[model samples]
Target: MSATTGAVLLYDGDCGFCTKSVAWLDQRNLLGFPARPWQSVPDHELPASPEALMTEVVLTRPGRRPLGGADAIAACVRESPSRLRFAGRLLALPGLRGLARAVYRLVARNRYRLPGSTAACRIERPG
Candidate 1:
């Protein structure tokens, strides 16, 4: 289907870790962004280049700017009904965004090497 109007949590289906993580979160149904593999997203409706797709988890909605990586996750938490909303706000704090991005990069970069990941899950870093 085309990218319809809804909060979609774009993930990498090829990544075992990513798939398992999304599955675990989907089971909980604790947030607004529902996870879907990037493979299902139409290329014309993507938020960024295809390369960036595998490098970050992205949150997208019709007629709105997409949020990526840690920010996307923080947005989900902020929109949640749980106490994690506090942490989500903190992630948007001045000094924390950089830290959060760094941590997200760490995980994204290592995801392929992590347990449950296959070689195809490795994202090629763009220059």
Candidate 2:
């Protein structure tokens, strides 16, 4: 879909944990934007580079540069229902942003070890 329609969250389709995470959010109706696997989105439609997509989740919105990693998560939280908007704001705080990014990176690097994650969750970092 075009960015004009709304935001889209792109994640690694090959990763089991990532897939499950998206599905989990969908089940709760917390995802304000459509969630698509980066693999399925056409290259021309992708807002971020292939290496970036493989490393972290990305969010694209109309007339805005894509947000990746913790920033993307904060944006998603802001877009969710009103009841949860505060958490989004909290995540965006300068103090928490760095912590969030660090945590995101740590989890992303070892997602395969998390519960419900599978062998497919293992990913190689781009040099």
Candidate 3:
């Protein structure tokens, strides 16, 4: 994909689960998409609140639109020509979309309780 088509994955830098997820994505070599931690995204540049970011995974597609939570994951899948991409498409279908979104929300809300999360993801307040 051209650099302009590249997607930016904004994740929680402090969460072990998030880190592991990023590592997994990296290993797949799924088009080698670049990822940036939410903490790394300059505060002045983000359109949404830091709290919003802490609550969802954000994916920004240059020259395109941004995706969050389940949509973001689907975007990642759609970017690659793999079985997962097909699965993502299936999940986007009407019947499955609700379930998929629900599951993503549940996991996102309880990420800290999951195996790799060290603590609940939180956004730092400006002093």
Among all candidates shown, the one with the greatest lDDT: 2
**Candidate 3 lDDT score relative to the true structure:** 0.71
Query: What are the runs in model 2 whose C-alpha is more than 4 Å off?
Result: 2-5
Candidate 1 deviant stretches above 4 angstroms: 28-30
TM-score of 1: 0.85
lDDT of candidate 2 vs native?
A: 0.85
TM-score against truth, every candidate: 0.85, 0.89, 0.79
Worst 10 residues of 1 by lDDT: 24-33
RMSD of each predicted structure:
2.1, 1.8, 4.2
Between prediction 1 and prediction 3, the one with superior lDDT is 1
- Tens digits of lDDT, candidate 1, 81-119: 775577888999979989999998898899988787888
Full-model lDDT for every candidate: 0.80, 0.85, 0.71
lDDT of 3 by residue, 1-127 (tens): 3223456777778788877877786677542347777787678766357788777778777777777887777667766656566766776788787788899888877787777778555334478
